[model samples]
Target: MTRGPGRWAVLSAFTVLAVVMLLPFVIVALNAVKSPAEYSSGGPLSLPHGLYLDGIVQFWQRVNFGQKLLNSLMISAAVAVLATLLSVLNAYALGIGRVRGRLWILVLFLLANTLPQEALVYPLYYIAKQVGLYDSRLAVVIIFTVIQAAFGTYLLSAVLGDFPKAIMEAAAIDGASRWRILWRVVVPISRPTLTVLMIFFFIWTWNEFFLPLVFLISNDTQTVPVALGVLQGDKMMDATMSSASSLLGIIPAVAFFLIFQRTLTRGVTVGAVK
Candidate 1:
């Protein structure tokens, strides 16, 4: 009986917290549908007279948001795929292979992750310029892939390190090559971790601003975040249009999360249990 009441109390507290956190999003969504005049004159918290698409349409045209969105999607997808693949291979080698100095290598990866992007950005810019990748989408993709791979390697290595070794021995006895065992056995079993890594990579790369802003100098090459910054800076777009653009910018990430919510939840729970 006491446990029941305690559980209810905790749930009630969490419910209130959720509502509080969601209040900003609720406010944004409401204001996004409002007309510019309404947004300027009426209170931000007030409801719109009616649902309107004018703000969204005007924002789309004013900022050339469609091209920016496409750029972000491409860069994010490429980074996620490349980073996840590299992480899986590196983790397998370091964790499951029991490589010499494996601990040292992981420590190096941890150190790499700890290094702030700001510290490396200038050096990276010089390198990209020399390599002829400066101001290119490929430049951002490559940079993020490497950066995200460090963290991904750390996570997947931890999970893979604890994986059952007996399975590896059994597969070896069946005359399986290392690559065969890794691809056929290990990867299949590590889908949850991979899924989690992919989701994180996608979200991080999609939301990235600094690198893209620095590297993507051309207007057409800029990603959504960079474009949004430009849109906010433009005097022509008032509050309503800015709000609409922001709403549009977040839709893809939110939709992606909702679509993969089950996989994400499973991955997190599995990681927790392990």
Candidate 2:
């Protein structure tokens, strides 16, 4: 049947893509468990003589992985929530209402997105310092929310554009306020998009390095990426330790995706269905 070939093609494509994406992780895993000499002498693709946890153990001890993870989680979670809410609100306002200046607003967001993040870093850093929030977790969260909001808003607006207008009219007929409609109707119906947004926001905030690298000076406030950088430098690029830290830094995002992959896929397809 046609279905058989189509299924095989899809599976084959996914397998190829997965292998491509996971190559670095594969290297990290093997190197994570390799002795330092074995790590350097063994090529990235080579097998190790025996499993060793020294690199991982040392990284944990040096970085205080638990505390860093907690900080990352708090910052990431806060950013996700704020970004999602702001995105949803913006999308609903633009999608459901007749705002005269909607096009200009959307254009401004798109223009900002086109500008490289590096271009604005200096100004944003100065502003953060002026606000007395430099080096704080709250500062990171706020920056993450603002920097990510444009793309999130654009994506959510596209999804909302495809949402059925009949539902909005019916809710209005039932005398529902915009807030009630957003909370009771739109959000529940757009659950998939929201999940995808949250996952992406979490990933972005968790892995953010450059902003944190520039702004945060205190070791205690360093996120995983910053911590990993310090570790990598301390080890003078010791392959085992570098690889172990890389693996540790990546696990949370990978696990999060694996846990919610179905929702992520559904979100992409559903949001794209115009």
Task: For candidate 2, write residues 1-274 as lDDT tens digits.
Answer: 3569889999999999999998878888998899988766867778989899988898888779988888888888999999988888888887666477877888888897898879978998999889999989888888889878888887777678768889988999999988998899989999987988898998888888888888777878888888887666573557888888888988988898798899889989976783
Show model 1 residue runs off by greater than 4 Å: 1-3
Deviation in Å, model 2, residue 28 alpha carbon: 1.6
Error of 1 at 15 (Å): 1.2
Clashes of 2: 0
With a 3 Å backbone cut-off (N, CA, C), the pairs that clash in candidate 1 are none
The C-alpha local distance difference test score for the whole of candidate 2 amounts to 0.84
Among the numbered candidates, top lDDT falls to: 1
Instruction: Residues 77-124, candidate 1: write the lDDT tens digits.
Output: 999999999999999999888899999999999999999889999999
Best by TM-score: 1
Candidates in order have lDDT scores of 0.91, 0.84
Stretches off by above 4 angstroms in model 2 are 2-17, 40-43, 235-237, 272-274
